[model samples]
Target: MCHHTQPVTGVPLNSCTSREKTSILQLLTLGMNSHTLPTCRVHHMEGRADPGRVPAAGGRPEEGDEADAEGDGPWPEAGDPRGEVGDFLSLDLGGTNFRVMLVKVGEGDAGQWSVKTKHQMYSIPEDAMTGTAEMLFDYISECISDFLDKHQMKHKKLPLGFTFSFPVRHEDIDKGILLNWTKGFKASGAEGNNIVGLLRDAIKRRGDFEMDVVAMVNDTVATMISCYYEDRQCEVGMIVGTGCNACYMEEMQNVELVEGDEGRMCVNTEWGAFGDSGELDEFLLEYDRMVDESSVNPGQQLYEKLIGGKYMGELVRLVLLKLVDENLLFHGEASEQLRTRGAFETRFVSQVESDSGDRKQIHNILSTLGLRPSVTDCDIVRRACESVSTRAAHMCSAGLAGVINRMRESRSEDVMRITVGVDGSVYKLHPSFKERFHTSVRRLTPNCEITFIESEEGSGRGAALVSAVACKKACMLGQ
Candidate 1:
């Protein structure tokens, strides 16, 4: 229910100005103010579609029920069905390193439980990374077999959770169709295939260990569940690494894809795919266009390309190239390394931005990249890196603000106090990114008090926890 009009700036319609150069940030802030983002619109319409429907889950109080006068459900109500006591296996396979974990959950006093975990990490070879699906999964199965042997649990059939950090169209808790590969992954026969089925087939081929794969979840969902163990208030999971995505608990009534309108379900907002519909064309500059055109998956995951670590370096490189062309850097002479694609790595962005008010650090990085930079050149490059990184942090915050506000409104809370579980190298390793991201999110969500908990080994633990929950639910249903 909003309208748009082209502004008359006393110049040609297509003419660019400083205001236009700064409008992307302004547009982000304004869109968040009006809750007009694509994410916000979808969340608001879906979450508030039914204001009076009673949740089928017994925890929520029904309207006009005298016993529920408090207006809030008991936090982690007695005998909560989510608690599961068992030993579970978790496999995390999103990045170049794959992990296998054995988690043991045991009952304790006063509804608390003790969790013990053992995990091993394996590096994925280049051949295995870009090979056929069978090859990729066979390597995974072999790793699991080796882990089970080390743990002396090769004969025990344990429930397993697969944490696949990619875009997936899930049909059930255990079945997901791989939409596409991201993070430089180009494994053949994976796209448009059931990810779990491929894993099961690979395990059968190995025949060294038996596993009951119960559920499959994205890394964000796993992080949320894992953090929920430490603080029950955690309902959102986000990753800002090679790619970006988030998942949060949503009222079941609002999820059209799922049948039951009861309690809540975690909805994975594959937000990296947000701008694929051309929603961000106005914000994209020539640098962004060039990066997109040369990417493995051109014109796809547009939002992620702008914010993810994989493309941030290339964006900076393009900007530096333009600066060279304008005679503003390196005396209008571009180094061969500067002209190379991906030569300016993403880590250089962090290193340059970490400079302590002196040009020494920036000069070192530029020189290492084959650039003979003067003091002015070093300063210019540092500013360019800061600009790119700042915009990325703000844009990510805008997306999260939309989610937090929607959650608060869905429950009719005057002030919602919530915790978000976060993971990934970009969010964790960048010196200023965490602070910048937190400040922006707080500014955007005025009605919410948010706490961000950085997760430790959360992906694997979360996958195991999700499997445990699914197993407990199945037991209750006698399935």
Candidate 2:
């Protein structure tokens, strides 16, 4: 029984119902796996660093090489060929809105470089979002052409980096096969296809410009690499916004999908799909199942459905509905607006949690939702928000703890130090999410000394940086 037990992972298990306690415990189990969590597929960075000393196929690096240096970091060091000095174009297509960015990298003294960038955001139409692959890519190409025309650089063959923020299996830095779509995307003829190839075909059809598609990366990988520019110690990158996922540098030996066991490679842990194999079924609550069934990708991205911003608000609304039915909130009544799908946005969760106990903010928000919330009703809503958000924070922390602990053990260190680059509205904008998340991560990863750095323009900057690194490596390898 969880009764009378001390709290773990910052969640007061003693105060939780039996089902809630089980859910938290299952998350801990998922995070504490000793081996690489099979729930996430391994997508390497194609071994971006140490390009010259490429390892033989399916073989380990020669002993005494830096690849064999156990305690050394995985990122490239200073004074190396970072990238060619020039402007690179990067496309970031993660959500309904995609960004087209022009990044200028200029060399400075002592191998350091200065980067300047300008970007434009274009919204994807509802038809395009749910259309065929060709339609979607063609729309994206049109956006790219417009951006290039605005910059008056359509003729210059610039290196391009594509940041497709979805789950993918990479055959190389430049080739990623779309495993499946998440975040409400349902473009046909995309799954199991090479996303880069589709974009290339679309660009070729456009015929208005030429580009050298250099590299493609997930948003998490981009965040990690982008933050690596400011902090070389940042080897892990995590995103906790509309969706939750993470990436980290892993020892080559553990990445069974890749060939060589030489240097470390970045692995995109599409951890949002963590519970799809029914590992989480035993702990899932009624509200969770409701959200999952209603989502576009039902029975998918199950872990993300619990913690991502896209679902947090829905979860809270369901809880509120439950409370109302139990006569514990709103006098056992629900407004018509509250009954509507998506009337309660995720932002409401943040706003409700931010209320300072005066209940003014809570009353205003509920009133807008057509609810006449009393003082007691406002208090109950606030408590419900805290419970949902806290669970989300704790669950996210457990996943990150698993990654950090795995890194520490792989390096054979008792106390491993690392820095993580994180980005997302939920993590950055929430009133108490960062603190709650940090506390649980520390409790779960006792052997790690961790530093968290919030990323700025992670997807845009990261896509460009990935291209830069790939370009530099290619030049060295004479490829």
Candidate 3:
């Protein structure tokens, strides 16, 4: 029972009711398999073309071929060739951060390949998120021009890769229709518009220099590509931070959205939005429901609400709020700041968990929130933090396990090793997150050997690699 005891107080995890604990376990178990995922189906492209449009014979996606699925969308496989010499540029206009990167890919010791990159991050203003698409793109373009000037690459006509980490309906490698926006971005008139075209137009408006938009990809896909560049066994890519999503190599035949040769393509499993049908609804506690109800997009990203970093602190806050009402926390006098939504952040939880069992950090956190916590109160807070963080770790493992299990259905036992390329602050900085996640995966899939590789700047590096892929394919088609 010590394993279940609080690290500071050595008391069993009795803070929550037995029923609540059972529900949390069920949530973790349900995600350990994919059959329960609401969005697990042949991905639909909404108004996109038929999957059978690609001829069964050999040909790239021409003007009429269904473009969103696979044919010529820079579909990189395990051993795709990446040239060793190029100074490529990449722009990432996804999530809250807009970035521009320049890469010099060349040879290293003993003819081995090496890559060096420089990138700058720009924060988007609040107005841009709620304003028109043109406003957002214009700001992004200005940043790119500034980055180029800093690197003295003002005269280069470099082939560029665009990483737009949003739901897009691909028309080709360099073009795609923005299907929808997520992660608190609501760029008006951006939805249903082509992001690549928007970027191209934005760049042209600048009228500075020539830059070709060679490919467009999400961060998850780029992470996988980056990993595959370093290791041949990486097939899955994931981003687990403020929000969570995954992409993996899947058979073209199994994907209802694409049709063509007998090959595999990366499928962006937007697992963050997996609980649309309320599959995991029953397991949600009052605190979880409160966070959902108060969210910017309620009743969406259900899986993320339970597992993502942004919500972890809020969940802990809500539970503590409940305990306060019941005279069990903060000595029955909760601070007004603690009552406010979004006041607590994930860093606080991490700090509490990493404290040396002396409760100093938790004491400081509560003091900041206008609460004075007794020794017992600190222990209670620690327990709550551990419960929420542990559940999040288990959920992440379960999601990864589900992906592995689905892949195994069609793979041979000879395929013994699988590598996943993942990035995000939560995985890198959170105390004990990776250990718990690895443990959970091993416990659930005892027979499979899975490795997690950290691919930093996956979006930037991947965009460079994918641009190379697109350029090579274009050359092949011209032959």
Candidate 4:
């Protein structure tokens, strides 16, 4: 619904004219090499900044302090800490879709289980995302009810694992205090609400189901758990889908949370806030600045905007709009539909760049937008995709590099063999995203051994695992 247009040439708006000229010169010199794009180098902008140092908190506790006060020992590891067989449910709540699944875990060779029911992906309405907490939870509860009924999972008091994919402050595994909304979700009353309580209330009201909401995990943490459950070598979990973020295991000794438990399981480090150091030499273009300035958590997640799927298409649009104003491409006529959200999805752009089918894909994209296109438009579209994606990939790599550097500084280990479990459409489906990220990581750490693994273990199943762990822990405490 956005109808904003780029200013025509010769119209000066604030410092945009100077910024645009600077960006153009930089782009001309860099050509197709996006690694050379100028980034904002301002140091210590405004926000809840990351200290860049490992926090004192170790692995999160099993329950709230009340559980600890009950003299309950640490939560039991999923299954036999050493063994690998258990049953869990995972619910992945993403920016655009909600996925739910039930999984059974077993040990090596015999350590296999069925998805029981196929995973369900329900598209979330935009209003639901930005509406009241009640409306949003009501919609989610309805979807969960339908899913349970369809799968015939109606009788059991199932322990549920909830993967709330947003930044949160957690006192333990069973709770997540919302920090702020991101990924375009501006729902009121949800920012500071307890996500677990909201979902539990919704589920209970919607289905009259007495389900125990056990663990509340982040998507990256769920990815780590899923990967570690499968392969012990998997140390890092990264999400490059709608938004970019990562989680990795940390030693208990390095975390301040565990004042006494220094010999415990690893803690999840929210690595998204790592690369905020103010030592940049590049320039942030006007559009990049605008996107950063207007984001829900502006000045934070700067790198995320550069790489995440949600912003890639917008970046391309801004660049294309600029090009149009300059008469470099798409000149003369402007496509009215191009200004809306998702007018040009990154996937479509990538297809336009890589498709070999007589430019059919480009034609289809243009047709969908009510924009007639000629053969010349194909080249323009392809170039735009390439330019935008390349920038995104480079930015992603830089973020990864920052993590690697931080890990090296903390652990000082020799090129630790780390496997990054990745989930999301951008990282999994996009043709150029993975390669570009890999290239950037290699540039930063030539000798560091790293592997990118796809996680079929989604949030829904992850949630189940968390539920199982929490239940097991609670039982030990006789709660």
Best by lDDT: 2
Q: By TM-score, how accurate is candidate 4?
A: 0.81
Model 2, 19-123: lDDT tens digits are 644544443332233222212211121221112222221112211111222334555452132556788999988776889999988877776777789999999
Poorest 10 consecutive residues of model 4 by lDDT? 41-50
TM-score of candidate 2 on Cα atoms, chains taken together: 0.82
RMSD of 2: 8.3
TM-score of each: 0.80, 0.82, 0.82, 0.81
Where model 3 places Cα greater than 4 Å from the true spot, the runs are: 1-81, 412-415, 476-479
Clashing pairs in 1: none
Evaluated against the true structure, the overall lDDT of model 4 is: 0.61
Which whole-number lDDT from 0 to 100 does residue 177 have in model 4?
A: 78
Task: Give the count of colliding residue pairs in each prediction.
Answer: 0, 0, 0, 15
Q: TM-score ranking from best to worst?
A: 3, 2, 4, 1
Lowest summed lDDT across 10 adjacent residues in model 1 is found at: 57-66
Better of 1 and 3 by lDDT: 1
Which model is ahead, 1 or 4, in terms of lDDT? 1
